[model samples]
Target chain A: MAETRQWRLASRPTGEPTRENFDLVTVDRPEPGPGEVLVKTLYQSVDPYMRGRMRDEESYAEPWDVGDPMQAGIVGEVVQSEADDFDEGDVVTGNLLWAEHAVADADELRPVNPELGPVSTALGVLGMPGITGYFGMLDVADPSPGETVVVSAAAGAVGSVAGQIARLSGARVVGTAGSEEKIDWLTDELGFDAAINYKETDDLEAAVAEACPDGVDAYFDNVGGPITDAVWPLLNVDARVAVCGQISLYNETEVPTGPRKLSKLIESRARVEGFLVGDYQSRWGEALESLSEFIQQDDLHYRENVVDGFENAPDAFLGLFEGENIGKQLVKVAERGE
Target chain B: MAETRQWRLASRPTGEPTRENFDLVTVDRPEPGPGEVLVKTLYQSVDPYMRGRMRDEESYAEPWDVGDPMQAGIVGEVVQSEADDFDEGDVVTGNLLWAEHAVADADELRPVNPELGPVSTALGVLGMPGITGYFGMLDVADPSPGETVVVSAAAGAVGSVAGQIARLSGARVVGTAGSEEKIDWLTDELGFDAAINYKETDDLEAAVAEACPDGVDAYFDNVGGPITDAVWPLLNVDARVAVCGQISLYNETEVPTGPRKLSKLIESRARVEGFLVGDYQSRWGEALESLSEFIQQDDLHYRENVVDGFENAPDAFLGLFEGENIGKQLVKVAERGE
Candidate 1:
């Protein structure tokens, strides 16, 4: 029997989930049953959306049950396989949990090869965030050549890829980040035409107007709040808005409110739509393929801040709200195929 | 020279416009020059959007200059014509003003035949309001047969036509109104499957949920604010929202702020689009033809609250915010010219 530690949801958090909200307990691991594979967790992705799952409220994904291990996107290596689909030492990435090991059905995980770059890449660029960025802007924003596409949270995992992809499609890309460092990275490294550090800016509306002189043709919104309000008036006629996430308001004790900008949508003849990645489950293959190509060609660049322990997962998760991570935030639980 | 009473923008209002905001004065009407016609205003449509134009602030249309005649959609008769396109005694509809008479370019006015029902129908059903209802729903909501469609301000001009159009397309229509009388009119006269007086309901979310058990497939939003917040969660997957107007928040001294719900958009795969009739400029012929057919066949019904006398126009316009009008609010300054 092997020892494993599982992080369970202790209680729903009022605001940000503290260490008290999660309980770490060690338990003996059982042998894999028929049609299942036991995977040793390697890398776990921490995202802004995971904060939403901490609440017992209804959302796109089911709420995490109290006393159960918190689920997350993880890359791991199979240690033992009772199913013929996966063998020992096979690398896999899927929605598992923040744990040392997970026993999942053979059909639950997809095999990943680190030869593509790094095992953690499967959790970021070639993973959920990558697919989210690829499909959303292409399928929803659908920017025409020479059109201006603006994205908020630009230096983050999804926004970074979205801006680059839009640029590749011949659209001018403008992005907004929280800090000057992130803005520089977005403009110089991620291929964004321009970037604005929203934190330092006094007038968001003026900043956006200056960055996008022609007005925003398409907007990929990730951090919705006053920033979104600023972007509202700048949207051109027939503009498309892909509402990815509202990380800015996710951890509030109450609903974070802003000016009702629904009227702006009508004034601009614009469209604002919210979409979950799960909605594109059938079309994920197409997204993955295009993203993989873009990555292979170096057209899209992804950065991951690796915190070296499973115990540090909570910090990494909390850092997402503070805008600490440069791109994708991930936690390496243990060595793979050990 | 003929005498004309013109209504001009006296001042911008902080919230709702008052009688003092409009200045009506009689002046000598200029003769129709080449390619222009002298129109005798019979009916001037009072819309919620005209309030937005009174301010010098930037909007879809340029703001009305101080002391300039406040423009609105009007149905008038050509008492004199100087262009080859129009002739004397021609009944026309144009984006005109609240005046007894005015000179306009022939190209700016469209001939309205009384054969298409009463000429006033040109101002309500066969004009901008009708086209707004038709295109806003068809292009944005795209409701499927047997799907549940909900609309706000359902007894008003746009909402009434939108609900009826959705019903004719095989959608079960649910509507929300501000008063009990409006609710009755919506359910009985407009053929809505269900109607709720939002003013009477303490819990809008629960009320909307009960009325739309399968969830709303399409939402024609005329009044956005707290009512929209209530309807947001009840939207089914891939629900379409056509944001026509946000009348509830329009008169606010400051922007009505609330929790940013950009994240909720992803949960429902919902789309909220703002649109103007100008976007459908090229498609007006198609919409007008279809709406005309619906009216001719008696498949669509519209009611108008016509206020008599040009001097009472300011009062009638101001009555919109008080919910005094039954349907389309119009000021009848003179009889329709045959």
Candidate 2:
């Protein structure tokens, strides 16, 4: 039997997840069944939303049970195939096990186009995070020309793209990030009109007010805590808020309390909508096409912070909460098979 | 010159407004200017939204400065007119001063149809509250047939109509109110599938869950405090929440802190929107026509807690915070002209 290394959930974290919550073990590599393809992992995605699946709570993502193999979006090369659509050596991407080798249904996997960009982008800018930001900004928030748009956690994979999309629409874009490097990346590289280093600022509201002098017409919320509380009161009348992620509250054992904001929504007549990228599955092709064109034209830029080795996957996931990654955080599990 | 009694803001309330915040004074009845009409107040609206105007903070409704005459939706008889649209003894409704008489541009006033039930319906079922519920339910939190719709403050003017409208759309309607009478009015009178007396219930979430077994698909939020917190977790996938009023939080001296809910919205992919009736001005005729048809067909029932005298208008307005009125709260100032 062929042996494969895999990561499994050792236990659920009470608050913030640690390296101890994950386990690495070698197991017998199962052969592909009918219509299944055995894939050798190249890169796997680590996202803020994955924090939600670690807990027992019912959320949009299914919770991972203790002692179970962890799963994530992975771009890999097909080593063996029982499916007619996939052949050995084909590079494909799908939600798969965090392992050196795993079998997935061929139907679930998408063929990665290396021609569009780097194959690693299949798990970053050209993948789930990119589509999430694309639909969330252009469709949900729908910022207009000359309007002010603010994006929280703006140097992260999703927020970075969301802000740039708003800027492309001719909106004045403002972004908030934790570090000075992230702030500079948002303003200098991403074409954001302004960026606020929230960790350095004593008053985020005043900082945001200085950045968004016209008031926020559209807000892409990724971290929902004091940053969101500050932005809530500054929303212009008829503001549109795209509630894509609440990475700030994901690790809290207890539901955190904050200033009641529905009253402010009424004052601004704001529309706050929570959405998942999977909901726009039918229209994802539209996003991928636009994102690829923007990338090829040098209009859209993306960053990847890749951690080498399958054993380090937990560290990369844990680092997300510590603000360690600048953009899409990924784990390079193995080299692509020939 | 004839004198008319008017109520002015004595001082901005720090917390809950009191009778002392109002100063009743006799002032000379204002004369009509060109394109203006002098309207004698007959039925003055005392609504929960008026509490927002009393604050010094900026809101959708213009804040009343200290000693400024308090203004609200008023159904009155035109005593004099300098415009071609209105004449003496013509019953009209407009956002007018809370007094025996005040001057308003003829363009701002809408002619009241006495044949459409009582003329006071112009301030209750056939007016702003009716129109608010109409659009908020039909347009914002649009419940599909067989979907579960939950309405908080379900016996109040906007809520009562909102609940009934959801019921009319073939949705399984649930409501929450303060009193058993209000509960009875919701379930028994307004055709709600279930009604929870929030004042009597120890666990509002459990009560809401029991009432909406399939989970809440739509929520018409009139009071946003504990009731909203309870309903937030029960939202089904793609639920819509129409935030019309936060009467529960309106009286708080400071912004109240509660369990953060944006995360729950992400779990359900729900959309929460805050809207004002004034924004739908161009299409109000559509609401009025539909509301009138529903009222005349006995498909919609309305209640009025008319405080008999204008001297008690402050009391009527104050009572809204206490959940005193079952339906519309109005102050009947005078009889229609002979």
Best-fitting candidate, scored by TM-score: 2
Best model number under lDDT: 2
Model 1, C-alpha of B86: deviation from truth (Å): 2.5
Query: Mind giving the per-residue lDDT tens digits that candidate 2 earns over B202-222?
Result: 998999999989999999999
**Which stretches in model 2 have alpha-carbon errors above 4 Å?**
none
The DockQ scores of all candidates, in the order shown, are 0.81, 0.84
TM-score of each: 0.96, 0.98
True contacts kept of each: 0.97, 0.82
RMSD of each: 1.8, 1.3
Give the poorly placed runs of model 1, Cα more than 4 Å off.
B336-338
Cα displacement (Å) at residue A159, model 1? 1.7
Residues A1-338 of candidate 2 have per-residue lDDT tens digits of 88999999999998999988999999999799999999999998888888888888777889999899988999999999999999999999999988989999999999997666689998888999999999999989999999999999899989888988998899999999989999888878889999999999998899999988889999999999999999998999999999999999988988799999998887788999999999999998899999999988899999999999888999999999988899899999888654
Question: Positional deviation of B267 in candidate 2, in angstroms?
Answer: 1.7
TM-score of 1: 0.96
